[model samples]
Target chain A: MPKEKKIRVLIAKVGCDIHERGALTLLTTFRDEGMEAIYTGRYQTPKGVANAAVSEDVDVIALSDHTGSLPIIAEAVLAELKKLGVTDMPIIAGGLLTQEDVKVLERMGVTGNYGPGTPMDVILTHIRNVAC
Target chain B: MEVFLHNLTGIPRVDEAISLMKARNIRGLTRAISIVENYEEGRDALLNDAFQRASEACFTLGFTGAPGVGKSTLVNAVIRHYRRSGKTVGVMAVDPTSPFSGGAVLGDRIRMQEHNPDNGVYIRSLASRKALGGLSEATKYALYLYKAFGFDVIIVETLGVGQDEIDVARYVDVTTVLLVPGYGDTIQMAKAGIMEIADLFVINKSDRPGADLLKKQVQNILYMKAEKERPPVLNTIADQNEGIDDVMEAIAEVRQRKALQGQERHRKRIVEEIRSSVLTRLAGDAEPHLDEMAGKVLTLSMTPIEAAELIIRRIQKGCLEDDEKNSI
Candidate 1:
């Protein structure tokens, strides 16, 4: 059998909201796909996400936020990444997102937005297409 | 003296640095690690030289949780227990940095000061530097430095509550998630992502109200999930050093299990390091072009999707270059 090099990814939940089932699901999915997945757990600031991204040296960064405040949180994180000169990293966000919220994240330069109930396979595909 | 001081500010040549580290020249190694962590100019040259000098002696343990969860006190108690067993310990207490001044509060050390004068104990307080995960970028190098110094155990304490602290679990051999009873609802514990990553659950301030109920709740939840294994829950009053030995025993047992299974936590850490290094390099390479890319997107000269595609391509190119270099 060929040795598999797991593509590393960091999955984090940003902001004050503590919901993480979706984030955990993503972590599981990434690992199932033979990816080395490190989950940052919950209540991450944008800097925390970026730092995890940098330190974990992830191929992609997937953020899960079920709370409705994704716009402000996304902006805060993306802005911090920009300030830190890490704007090259791909960021994909998921959670209980509205269509409008998806639009906002898209404009903010997120790779893609996955709303609630999106299949794990679908999220995985997006992650690979954008991050790998 | 000037050369020594310069080496203190600069990265040391590897053999000299490693010899110094083995000699437990804490100031020299600490300065070297600080330079690496800060990515100070010319630090890379020093790190390359020192990288092989350290002995990789210790297993790293990361303890993390919300503020007021008694993480510092718990770490102190755990360190004290380890010291009793005649183990040499290194502690890195990560504190939050003031956003305005870029200085740290360094509060985690205050609770752990009792162990300050012990030769067996080495404690260093680090400011988060606004980096995510409440860990300094130079953490890996610092671990190597400690390992070179012959420490058997390295414990990293996080700044505050959240995902960054949880991420520490990935790097350490065993991660203990600390919970303070009555901070929030039982649902908060479940929601915090600590449920999945923590190898052991520490209910600090067990003397507090609802400690038993919280323990039962966690146990029941663990049973319901019925995963491969359930993390053991221990009650502790860290302030009083109660139940600390049991916690240490649990840690030792887990370490034994991990060793018996032939699982190299260091291998996982190395993989993480490679990934982090590659991504950081890719990101660093692409950073210089962001303004150009952003300008194209903002001026309507390039569509957002196209701009993103271009950036991704550039990052991928960088990764490819890194891969080729590593292979050679």
Candidate 2:
């Protein structure tokens, strides 16, 4: 019998960001939504995130940007994922984003750009929609 | 990396996976562990193949005790000590699975943040999924995977449930059961199954008042048994990073002692694994009969052991048939 697969998400803090309050807080939020969430602790590089994402076999990679490092970090992480032959693993951005930033990130192949204080219910719904 | 080329499609390539694992590719090891953990097709065969081909000689160290003993904190301390000597460490920290959500919080990763950036240390957190032993049943397989990943030391940390205390002994070469001062009933816990299996007994949080008493109780328990080289009982305040050196030395001593025993203890562990595997399979097969059996036990009509025997007899007579044990 084929066992049912659970949605596994990698909640990570990318770049040299120390503002992990959002990332740490979202750990249980994802788990409560019936998703297996693995947190990447502080000081994560894009290469490390890409490696951990591939190694952990996570379905979604959500990057929490505390600094303004997401644009470059996202591009580097996407390149690293490409190195591993991953093209469409939904790379989502959360926390402290503006409309202009969202437009730029979406144009650069990021699937979702969510802002701070976005309800977990809405976030999980979007993840389920894109992930499934 | 070349070995992972086999499982592009179809069933998981057990042989190629073994090759990739032997060469210590993190991606291959991670994917293979996922397959076994999820109980995908041929999971047991893959694990058996890898067990035979890759990791028959890796040393496993187990850390377990009752909850609130700072097991994770102590694990972080030991991992740091090992890494100082240029040894690679792989940690498997198990936490309880959420019954409502079926996902684990996995808080151990936060405590082990120091090793996150260290390439020499690899940490994987597992949820104790439906295994009565209070461990992810595939933990032993994870140990093998980590061993094959070029780690010099593999540590398996249980959720500290009493049921899983003996389970760690099946896989590890050395076991350290951590206790704290003023642990309510330390002496009573010293009489548990976990204490008997320990190669090193640790009194963590030794800064507290009852630390010496706990040590005395553990010593008394050790004295009751006959032994050649007695298992050392030591004190440590792991959170403060005090006494970690003595703990490491005790582990080294125990490793040497286990090596001296050779295959004698290994043979016994295999026997225990076989028995445990068989009984778990039997119970799984007789699941439909369990409610009635429980009712009989409640009514005092049959003992649990009798019920087990009856299940075994039924299985032997072809009355119950189930899948093979995929619990590593």
Candidate 3:
């Protein structure tokens, strides 16, 4: 029998963004929702997150950027993923983002622009749909 | 940069995957491990090929200890030492699966992320998946694939464990147990499970108080076993990379002296593997009928033992019928 597929998500932080509260919250939520969450901790480079996502074969790349480097970090992560030949890898961004930042990330094909105050259920539902 | 095998529609044929893996295609290796880990179709065949390609060149080392005991940090340090010697390394780090959600946060990679850019090292995190021994079933199979790819050293780090959970010892060449000050005292050290299996013991965070006392306590235990070569107990501040060289030297010494015994252990491991596979098969076959068996016992139609016997008999009969049909 084929085993049930569990949605694997890689939650990471890039650059000097030492903030972990948002990233850790998402990790806990993923686990509670029955998704395999791989946390890379803080101080990751954009390339580091991409390499990890590929190695882990995660279903989604969740970038936590409270440093407001969301657009730049998300762009780098996407570029890195593209360089790795993973054009279709889903990228999601969350954290203290302005509307302008969200628009920029979405233009780059990143989805789930979740900022603080986004309900847990909403985030979970979006991932379930995107991961499939 | 290569596309992952799973990203493609169907599972690749064993030969196709094997060739890609032989060429050191990281994506192919990752996908092959996933196949074995998830027990997908063609898993056994893939593993058969992997086992045939395995050689003794890849040395597997295991690191196990309690939670927050610096297992991952020590593993990171060891990987650095191995890389400095220009050796390729593969690491399989196991973390506990949440029994309720059936999910896990595989955070061991966090400590070892410095090697993320280094192609010479591969780190895969495994959730224990309810395996009581603090290891996942996929670990041994993943080792086969890692060996086939020709890593110079393979490391298996078990989830933070308590006094027992010595299963990692059965799968690796050397089992290094890490202890910290205040973890336990003399009687805790004398416990028969985790402490007894170590070919080497490391007192990590040795900069803390009570480190020397812990080392002496471990030595006292080793002294009781006069006939055997005493496993060395070393001190280290793993995060700072202090005393790591001594640990590496001790591992080499243990490996060299235990060469003959290693062969014997390998043979026993083969038997254990086969036994586990068969048991898993039987358990899978038995699962579907368990509810009915329980119902019968609840109704008092049969005792639990009788119900168990009936289920076994039915399974045997079904197997015999299948064999007869195949023969015809």
Candidate 4:
């Protein structure tokens, strides 16, 4: 019998801010849920994230940015994704996104907007929904 | 088909494969590690075949310390040192389990973002989830697999707070215990467990106040236990990469000493492994019947003590055949 291939995810935190609690939390959550997640650490640029996504060939790219600069970073990341021809890959954004910000991020092609106190299961379910 | 053949043969064409690994070929190393880690599934044959083909160029180091001790920073320093020497390093950082979510809080990887560009270094963050020893039991297996894949150094950074973290020392040739100054009574809490296993003690954040005093205290404790062979202690500020060279040198020295002292620690490690294995197996065997037994006990069909006795007896009877085989 052939073993099932695990879902691969790339969890990256973009922008100059050093806060990575959300990203780390997501990485661990994915692993515990039996998913293969490649963590890009913290303080990554949009290009770095896009490059990693292309190299890793991850099913999902989860961006965790706690710094209030998500609107700009999301736009840059979406632009990079489009440029790299990776628009098919789901880009989920979490961490400190307000309702209005979420709406804006969605328009920019973000798949999910996760805020503080959001359950990891919710993120996992969302990834499964989008990637599977 | 090539991967399958590689798995069957247990031999890595070391020069070619290691060069591939050193060039940041993550896919190659990842595949090789999977093969080696699953040795019981007959990948050992392939690894043995690869063994003659691979270089004997690997060092395995274990890092453990309390939370907020700047272990990630120290690990970053260590990675930078190895990178400067043109050696490929694999870091496996084990993070604490999130109590709320039953997942890992992989915060350590976030703190060491600068090293991402160094293609020679592969940093993996692992969550310690319900694993008794604080490390994923597969970690030692993973380390050896990395070695087989030709990583020059594999650093296992573990969650530093519990018994599981201390168990990490048994698996590595050198274990460094990281500490920070003025951690208050947290030092006292960890002293008994961590002090015993540390191959070397590192006082990181040396720029902070009380660093010297903390070092003195640790030194004094080691002095008191000098009868049992004390590990050397050093101070470093990992954020700035201070004193990392000295730490690495000390680690190398310890590795050499262990090589010379070979099998002494290995035998002890085997004994510990046996103990843990037996307990885990016993638990697995007992768990399924636990609810049934509890129901019986609740109904007064059997006392709680009697239920436990029955479980032990069953285990004993089950092992009797193996015990006889051993005797014969």
Best by DockQ: 3
lDDT of 4 at B231: 80
TM-score, predicted candidate 1 vs. hidden true structure: 0.61
Better of 2 and 4 by DockQ: 2
lDDT of 2 by residue, B1-328 (tens): 1112122322226565666666565556766777767767667877776656655555688888887788899999999998888777778988777778887666666567666656567677777765666566667667656755656788899986663357887778998888888765644755657767788889999998999998887887788666756789999999899999999988988898779886898898778767766765665678767788889999999999998788768767664233333332
Q: Give all candidates' CA lDDT scores.
A: 0.68, 0.74, 0.85, 0.69
* Candidate 3: stretches off by over 4 Å: B1-16, B296-303
* Candidate 4 interface CA RMSD, Å: 9.1
Q: Please tell me which model should have the higher TM-score, number 2 or number 4.
A: 2
Worst 10 residues of 2 chain B by lDDT: B1-10
TM-score of chain B of each: 0.82, 0.81, 0.92, 0.75
Name the candidate, 1 or 2, with the larger lDDT value: 2
lDDT of 3 by residue, A58-101 (tens): 88888888878899999888877776667887888889899999
Measured with C-alpha atoms, the lDDT of residue B185 in candidate 4 is: 52
Clashes of 4: 15
Candidate 3: CAPRI quality band: medium
For residues B1-328, could you state the per-residue lDDT of candidate 4 as single tens digits? 0111021111235444444444545544554444432223444444554445544457778888788888888998888888787887778787665555454445565566676544566666555544556575545455655665667788899876743357788877788988788854535734567768888899999999998888888887677655435787899988887898999898887787668666787687668766765665587678767998999999999999999999988878878978999999
Work out the TM-score per prediction.
0.61, 0.81, 0.94, 0.70
Tens digits of per-residue lDDT for model 4 on A34-121?
6667687767888667655643445688888877777788788777666645567788888888788988988877878988998877
Clash pairs, model 3 backbone: none
